[model samples]
Structure formats: C-alpha cells, structure tokens
Target: MTDQPTTESKGQDGPAVVADGLTKVYDGFVAVDHLDLTIERGEVFGIVGPNGAGKTTTILMLLGLTEPTDGSARVLGMDPARDSLRIKSRVGYLPDEVGFYDDLSARANLRYAAELNRVPKAEIDSRMDQLLESVGLSGTADKRVSEFSRGMRQRLGVAEALIKNPEVLILDEPTVNIDPEGVRELLDLVQRLRSESGITVVLASHLLHQVEQVCDRLGIFVSGRMAAVGTVAELAAGIEKGHTFEVEVAARAIDAVTLMELVPGVRSATLDGERIVVTADRDVRPEIVELLADNGLGLLGLSTSTVDLDSIYHTYFTGAVNHDNVNA
Candidate 1:
C-alpha cells in the first residue's frame, strides 16, 4: 500500500468534530478513556470496534445525551455539553435500533420527525417527499412502517434523520440486522449524501466490511481506547507485518526456493502446486515478473494481498500490537 499522510498531520481550519481526551466512567468502570479524535468536514469517518468497546458511549457523549466523566468534545464548533440543543439542530443521528410509530406510514413518520425538529409546517410536505425519494422509500411512503422489512425500515430511518437537512449525520450501526442488498443500498445512500450534499458523516459499527466500504478514514477502538486511526492503506503500512503475493507460473523451470533467493525484498517463498506464495516487505509483483522472465518461466497469474482490517483489529484487541506504541 502506498503511504499517505495520517489524519493527525493534515492541516485544516477546524474539524467538523473534535474530542479532546474524551473520557467517560461509570460505577468504577471506564467506558471511554482519553480518546482524542478529529473528523474533518464533508468526510465519512468510521468508528469501528466490537460490542462494549464504548462506541455507543462515545456517540452519546458527542450528542450530549450523556456527560463525560472528564475531558471535552465539540460538534460543529459548539460544545455538546453547553450547546446540545443548538448542535442537534445541525446534526442528525440514527441509533442502532431505529424506532417509529409502527402504525404510521413511512411518510407520516418523516412528517412527525419534521414536526419534532420544528421544520416550518409550510415546507414539511416538500421536505418529506424529497427525503423519502432520496432514500428509495417513495413507493412505500404510504405503507405502514410495521409492514416494512428491517432493511426498509433502516432506509426510512435515514430519511427521517435527513428531514431537517442537517450538516452532519451520525449513524450507529446503520446496517445492523439488515439484509445484504439492504446494506448495499444504505451504504450507497451514505456515499451519495457526502458526494451530493457534502454532509459530514460519522458511522459507528462493529462490522469491518461495511465500515471499510463507506469510510474515508477509520478509528479503531479496543477496550475503550483508540488503537489506531488511518485509511486502510495507511493502517496496513504502519504494521510491522509484511505483505503477501501469490503468483501462478505456467512453466515448471523456476523453483520457488531459487526465486526467493534472487528477489531483493522477498522474505519467504513456497510452492503449492502451480502457485507460489511470496511474503515481501512491499509490493514485489514487478520483481517477480522480471525474475520469472529472466528464468524463461511464463507467469499465468499474479495477485497481491495486504494486511486487512480484520487482522489489524485482532492484533490490537488481542495485545499482539502493543497499545502504548500505537500512534492513534
């Protein structure tokens, strides 16, 4: 993976969200510990961790629904503790389990949300239509929410969150219990929201693939502390582990052991049938091609794999990676 600047090193006028040494404790248990995070405007930032990793607590604190035991946080340049109502006016949040009046139609639910947000009654109908259509619920706008599937309801929740046309959207496990197709639709909607409306998004989830699919950058939380923060490529490069490349050769003339010795960056190479798996400090596909060509060997296929988020998450949470050494 190519190296890129870490989010911490990037210069900006001000972040969309900032948490300084954010800490939360309850009944002698530390829920969140000295967590510092910066989310830029118009970017999708993901907070990923397993259940009970303090993801929900962090969200609650940011929304001013729960006070921190120590430290401070700001959303859109306003203190959540002191300016929660003002912040709520500019931010939209969808919880892990979205609730609506079951008997109400999708349109009615959105109208209700608009009313609660104090949206002008004159514009509520247009706003509801726009939101419902945007989230792909126009056809089901009159359908009772109770008859909607989990995925449909999740999409409706997104529309409800957008009724006030907020600048920032905070979603807690938006895809939980959703079908695969529903998940795709929701992620696409999120991507469109940022691209079309330039709305800053904060998505918190335990699912790696979903987060990886949507976030511009990620903050990995483990045991109530941020373990790492960066893009997928940046995170992979930060780890000490080398990458692996697999090459399939058509000719039998080349030996895996011989190739391993000749390659400059290869750490190890082993042949499995027609395929050779090589571990290298960096991408060595070009070097392998050169070696095979020089040895009169024909390459059938070549592919590279890096340290994925799953491995990185496991390493940090299991103490394989020292917590103190992590830059985040």
Candidate 2:
C-alpha cells in the first residue's frame, strides 16, 4: 500500500538481463504484458508460475526465440531479437522438451551442435568431453540418444546445450522429466557452471523449493503478468502488517485476559485451543514473553511463520492457476 522504492541489491557485474514494457500477444490473447525485470549478472534467476502464466513467453523473448509485441529486451547488452546469432553464441538454452535423432549417438549429436556453432575442430573433442562429464554422460557418449532412458536423454540435452560454454543459460524445467537423483545432479551442475564460469542462469519452473534453493532472485507470473519479483526475503517483506501482536491464552489461565489488557499495544486478546497463533505488524515476541512471565502463565509454545511465495501467487491469480504448492 505504501509507495516505497525497492532497496534490493545487485552486485557489481550489472544486470545480465533487462526488460522494459515487454509484451507478447497471440492474436487477441496476451501471453505477456508490460513486464519489467532486471536480472543481475552471475546470479541464478528463476521464473515461476502456473501452466499458462507467460513464464515461457518471457524466456523466449529473452532468448530471441520469439519477438515481443511491444517494448524491448536486452540480454548481456545485446538486443536478443535483433542480435539473436550474437546472443546465441554466448547463451546456452535447454527447451522444456529436447528432441534428438534416434539413430545418432550422443557424441554425434553434440558434435553436430558444436559444428553448427562453429566451434573449432581441434576444440570440439575437448569441449564435448568436458560437457558430457559435467552432465554425467561421459560413459554414454557413444550410446544412441533414442536408446537412452528418459533420465539419460535429459542429461544429453543438458550437455548439448552447453557445447559452446555459453555465458548465460536458459533452462525450461531442466529437472522436470528426471527423477529426484537426476534433479540433484542437474541443479548441482548449474551451480557449478555459475560459480566456475561466472555464467548467469535463467530458470523457469513450477517448483518453488527448487527456486528458493538455487535462485538469488525470482519473479512470479500470474495471468500473463508479473505479480511479484524480488529475492525470497524481499517478497516476504512486501506483505502488510495488520497489528503488532495477537496472543490467545490457555483457557485454564483465567487472568490471561486481564493481564494482556494492561499491556501498551495489546489491542485485542482471545482464547484459542491448546495453542495460540498471532498476527503481528512488528515482531513482539520479546514483549509478549516478558508479560507472560510476570503474569505467572505457563506459555506452552510459540512459533513464527511468514506468508510464502505460494500465498503470494494465489493472491494475484486467485483460483486461475492449478499447480501443486511447494513448501516455503
């Protein structure tokens, strides 16, 4: 409700990606609308939303896969739509579903990509070797992609995407088709690339916990628009505080109501079940504990929780998005 400027910090490398009034429309349907986002260099940036929340559309624009309807976007200081070839050379991309030749071996597939990108013949062997190892597909380099399992195929997809050792990585649900173990491997590889190569990552997924774990910042899209964008803690701080504290006394403690009423900021008090949940505008745990001590009431337990990304997603889309809620 307040008109406060965002105070989030982005380290000195500058924004890796920038968008201003970017919009994408298909006929009369709008897929993205006036989205303004800035992703810092060397940071893991995640885009999370429902099935049709424009997450992919936004990525497409950033990767130069789709032209925007209005506004502009710059990826690593180049206009992605106009400088696509220039952009692609410095970027790695893994689509939601990766397709490969059934007859070709993994080595063949990677060599073909490397050649297309004009990697030198002398460098291709070493490049392919390193990429395959990074994705844990070194042993299967000679295996035909079609004969590979779903997990194996996914790993090959990741290796292929990195053939050029791009500076920015665009991944669309890289962990979606894989098992838990595979997911961990992929995430670890992504972190390594960012740490060792100083690459910036743009990840799109419906998995909030994964975003929370890997991303330095995130944006939530709802019904074709950005609902919230910031670091996890910044998003948590955006919710308004209604009151300073709420405390419910145990029914067995009769003087609970009288004692709480004497406190300065105690506007309301009630008795709940065996436990009490309070809504506080400001943290009042210290004050509450002292008051409870003086009143001789046994405070059984106290805990604090915050409104998570799932709640923020729903607040913007209402019942429009049907996705599993992840633990915040």
Best TM-score goes to which candidate? 1
Give the lDDT of residue 239 in candidate 2.
47
Q: What is the lDDT of every predicted structure here?
A: 0.84, 0.75
Candidate 2 lDDT score at position 163: 83
Which pairs clash in the backbone of model 1? none
Worst 10 residues of 2 by lDDT: 1-10
TM-score of each: 0.78, 0.76
The candidate that wins on lDDT is 1
Report the C-alpha lDDT of model 1 over 186-276, residue by residue, as the tens digit. Answer: 9999998877777789999999778788899988888788888888776666664556777888766246457755788887787776777
Candidate 1 has a TM-score of 0.78
Task: Tell me model 1's lDDT, rounded to 2 decimals.
Answer: 0.84
Q: Across residues 130-183, which tens digit of lDDT does each residue of candidate 2 receive?
A: 888878888988988888987788778878877876767888877776788878
Cα lDDT over the full model 2: 0.75
